[model samples]
Target: MNDNDVVRDLTLDGNAVAGLLEEVFGADMTTADGECAHCGSANAVGALRAYTRAPGVVLRCPACGGVIARIVQTPRGTLVDLRGAAHLAMRR
Candidate 1:
């Protein structure tokens, strides 16, 4: 599909992922820091523009408008793709 076709489906923000992230990462991940792989924009995951309506959830950078992450659920398991993020800094 075209880029617009994909982006037109975005309907939420990183805040929408708090619960799911807690399940997988064991804590609130929305507040974590993330750097964009495409444009090097560094910001909190909560700051990323999130689209929750689609076959999967898509997160994009607010500064450069590049995709930062994608989360999909399948029959086997939940798949989280982070290739769009160059750095995912979590609190220790």
Candidate 2:
């Protein structure tokens, strides 16, 4: 496939994570604040970048291109990884 096709296959907006994050956190997490582990920049989870290619979805820091979260859906279950995020602020 061409580069455009590849990008189209893998690329997505951060808003795509809203539903999954809500399922995980039991609330709307799109407006939640998160800090990038790599650059320390802070922003809303909905403002990050999203990639949905390989076997799962990946959310990246908009500031330094750091991976903020990863979500993989398997036959048995879904796995979520947030190792690249330093901190997340939940609403009160």
Candidate 3:
């Protein structure tokens, strides 16, 4: 997708977007290594591991721990938010 497309569709806050990406891409359970596009970090063991929990799924820089934006796929096409079963928390 182009930058304009991303700006229009995934305009939500960064953290929310991160969570959404994680859910959509199965980041939490991912076992593959991914490079952080921002800081060029190569520490993403899984999809979720590439992000930081503090900022609510903010993509972390593997080399410098910087935050980066991530894109995820969905039934409605590519999305920037975590709106799947994985992102949902169980209620007590």
Candidate 4:
């Protein structure tokens, strides 16, 4: 196998991380609205495609398949990368 051949074994819906998201964000983020920075497609967080087979969790846009977010856990703390998301709107 080559390093380029990333084996993504499983694909799940964002809803699968409901408990994790609530633990991290302290709210139900699955219902949040997010805009993809790459494709500019707006979608609910629950609708984003989720891949958890890697070291971290990856959320991808359903429209363009652009990465929307990455959540990784480290010794010190958890790392959240949202560069792929233009903005995430949480309901009050």
Best by TM-score: 4
lDDT of 2 by residue, 1-92 (tens): 99989765666767887887787779998888999999999989888889866688899988788898998888899898999999999877
Q: Model 4: runs farther than 4 Å from truth?
A: 1-9
Question: Which pairs of residues have clashing backbones in candidate 3?
Answer: 19-82, 20-81, 20-82, 27-48, 41-62, 41-63
Best by lDDT: 4
User: What is the alpha-carbon lDDT for the whole of candidate 4?
Assistant: 0.90
Q: State every prediction's TM-score relative to the real structure.
A: 0.82, 0.83, 0.34, 0.87
Score residue 59 of candidate 4 by CA lDDT.
92
Model 3 Cα RMSD, 1 decimal: 11.6
* TM-score (C-alpha) between model 2 and the true structure: 0.83
Cα deviation of 25, candidate 2, in Å: 1.8
Could you give the candidate ranking by TM-score, starting with the highest?
4, 2, 1, 3
Write out the backbone clash pairs for model 2: none
Q: What is the model-wide C-alpha lDDT for candidate 3?
A: 0.42
State, as a TM-score between 0 and 1, how close model 4 is to the true structure: 0.87
For 1-92, candidate 4 gives per-residue lDDT tens digits of 55434443367879998887888899999999999999999999999989888788999999999999999987899999999999999999
lDDT of candidate model 1 versus the reference: 0.84
Cα lDDT listed for each candidate: 0.84, 0.85, 0.42, 0.90
Candidate 3 residues lying further than 4 Å off, grouped into runs, are 1-22, 26-29, 46-56, 70-92
Let me know the TM-score candidate 1 reaches against the reference structure.
0.82
The superposed Cα distance between candidate 2 and the true structure at residue 30, in angstroms, equals 0.4
Better of 3 and 4 by TM-score: 4
